[model samples]
Target: SDGQMPQTREHLLLARQVGVQHIVVFVNKVDTIDDPEMLELVEMEMRELLSTYGFDGDNVPVVMGSALCALEGREEEIGVKAIDKLLAAVDEYIPTPQRDLEKPFLMGVEDVFSISGRGTVVTGRVERGNLKKGDEVEIVGLNKTPLKTTVTGIEMFKKELDQAMAGDNCGILLRGIKRDDIKRGMVIAKTGTISAHTKFLASMYILTKEEGGRHSGFGEHYRPQLFIRTGDVTVVLTF
Candidate 1:
């Protein structure tokens, strides 16, 4: 609690690298430290570190409490009351993501499995929209021609589901897809929602050596694997 750990700083740097705009700090184990000044010192150090990493340190919410105490049902200052305060701070500070379920259904195929009696099952978390049994979906990407199939069944956590929506991590059984027709690195979406493309423009972030990344940079014509959603494809860089 005196200061942020080395791993915490590394994680913060990675978060910044990935364009994280907001953060909520939780200075846990406050009950163990008898000195209020120590807690203040920890908060000050945390804020300074946040500022160093390009975050809005002054305005960031830092909730101090003891999760162990809260779990033990303790009635101390750093117990239940502090847990409530942390939740309130999160509610006020962290903005809710605008996940619209009405958007066209899209899911990145993470894993593919072939069932002896079933045609094929693709499992992944739904990126947007909804799907139900018998809904038609298209397999797109990996520079291949798109393929269309129908959802025969849906299963999540061993339970069969009639439908799935955005953020659902489930497997959908396809009606006529062969095990070899689809694999990882493919996007399954509502028919006509997406298409396969060979090229795209993008802004890139290259991590430095100090950040546990490359020790040297590259120039044009360099071939690097570009990762998008759940797909990773190698491509040549252009000027």
Candidate 2:
């Protein structure tokens, strides 16, 4: 209960496996630690742990503060300085999205909805480049064969836009595509931009029984239901 939680490490590994390169570590309840040396020690340990996981530990910013104090609506408790520090760190360490207009269009469908007159609409943030009306897009990662469709319309913030670039949330209308053809987590890219893969590569770190919080260890060939976005799939393990 005192050291780093096992689940936290697992989550970081999962994030990296899924293409998350940068991370911000927020150390909460700093006011509870009275000794300065103890706080320093905590920081040192966190750096060591993060370094082991291929993260930039030395230059990485760690913001220590207490949310409970800030929630009290008074500056007397630990003050607002800690919160300010955290926000400053976020602005400094977090890199802005690189939106390249020349790059191919890519968007991960966050949600799919059925409209009365719109036929089908998929809402998501443009991951890169831009998505425009009448642009041919290929859907991948849901199944073997990719479905190709054209963007009929793009709407951002309730206003119809000719196109949406990376980092903008927009609902896109598809031509002749139904709500059933699209789902969350499926990536839509420009035609000839994405290729299907049979196997996924991962640098995974498995958990022990105690860390996994299971009564018994998972045996070989064990199958587990994997949850991704708004769907679940049962997968079998080998070796």
Candidate 3:
């Protein structure tokens, strides 16, 4: 297997940041390696890296294989057989994410429009929970003060609806809030469920030149656009 690279490390950081609890590592290109000990070393290094990122490194599944060989249907030791083992490991290790409607309602604002006689309407896919007409919600994020508003109406495909839930792309009309007050990066959620986070600590991964990333290095003052949900806000990085 090819040894871990900078991009792999970056990916690990992102996965850990996004609350990935389990990892099934497929150590590809094992056919290129002539030494068995090298493969063992790679696995050991991978486990250590996983542990460093708050994963169950010692027990994380690691499968060695050559994807090219598997596609060509050659070398069963590092081909189809290994792929089968990898698939088995993945099926056994990764857990399905629960998409329950019982969760709090949250929708990221993607577009905002002002209705002539009604009020400001924000359109986006409902991320979780359910929202009904007259339900109070909070508009958060976009580096602005949080606004409390009532869901005066919900519409999907230009048809008025009494309620909307997770996975539905709908427009929500708010009471009292002007279209200028809401932006694309803002979020509307069940009141008091979430707050706008102006500052927080995070593990950041800067890509290397070999990964076709930044050729130059940045420092603590680097301000990069941090994208969360549908929002992208410029954030200052502290070393």
Candidate 4:
């Protein structure tokens, strides 16, 4: 399934709750606003919204683009230029995490599905280390003993790849594992890197809404979807 785009403040908050250290905000529809001052005000509002969502306004990179116009292919030159600028900003600001290849590989499963003849296929962005075709990996948190399975297939960006490195999103085909054994929100790691826990401790600040009684209760249960790494889970919050 295609990943859902976050809409509300809570949705962005949920993204942060998952393990998103860096965020890129693309403010589309700049072509609609003809006034410069009005555009500045909109930009300010965007920054404020991001700050309210637990992001540093100065740190988080925001780009102005028109996705709709770009798709229509009317103003091709302007659209391509805007896209290039956005790509440059992303490359400059987002710091890619360094991975230790020698260390154990841990991939948090973000998506899972079944194939016609290939059986179960799992896809996730690799957080650390490297995984190669024909290599054996253990599925943690699902079973007690590490089930040794061969990497039947691997793909990166629609290209058939022999291996996947850290920070690269990949789809993998397993040999022995059944569809019932593999589940979304599970981590495929090298033996012992992932630890399963029933409870976790976290520090969170409640974002105040424009409407006054939104966050009135200090200890109310807040159940929001949590995305950590490539894993998505529902976290019950008490604040």
* Minimal lDDT window, size 10, model 4: 1-10
C-alpha local distance difference test of each model: 0.88, 0.79, 0.87, 0.74
Query: Any idea what lDDT model 4 has?
Result: 0.74
lDDT score of residue 204 within candidate 1: 74
* Segments in model 2 whose C-alpha atoms lie over 4 Å from true places: 1-3, 12-21, 31-37, 76-80, 97-103, 115-119, 140-148, 157-159, 192-232, 237-239
- Measured by C-alpha RMSD in angstroms, how accurate is candidate 4? 5.5
Write down the TM-score for model 2: 0.70
Give the TM-score comparing model 4 with the true structure, all chains together: 0.70
Winner on lDDT between 2 and 4 is: 2
What is the per-residue lDDT of model 2 for residues 142-206, given as tens digits with 9 covering 90 to 100?
67788989989999889999989988989998888878888887888999998866456445456
Native-to-model Cα distance after best TM-score fit, residue 168 in candidate 3, in Å = 1.4
Which lDDT tens digits does candidate 1 get at residues 1-239? 44566678888898998878888998888877988888888989899999999999999998888999999989567888988988888888889766669999999999999989877999999999999999999998764588988999999999999999887899999988888888798989999878887777987777677766788889999999877788888999997
TM-score-best of 2 and 3? 2
* Local error of candidate 2 at residue 63 (angstroms): 1.3
Distance from true location, Cα of 121 in model 1, Å: 1.9
State in Å the error of residue 193, model 4.
Answer: 3.6
Question: Could you tell me the TM-score of candidate 1?
Answer: 0.74
Model 3 TM-score is 0.59
In order of lDDT, best first, we have 1, 3, 2, 4
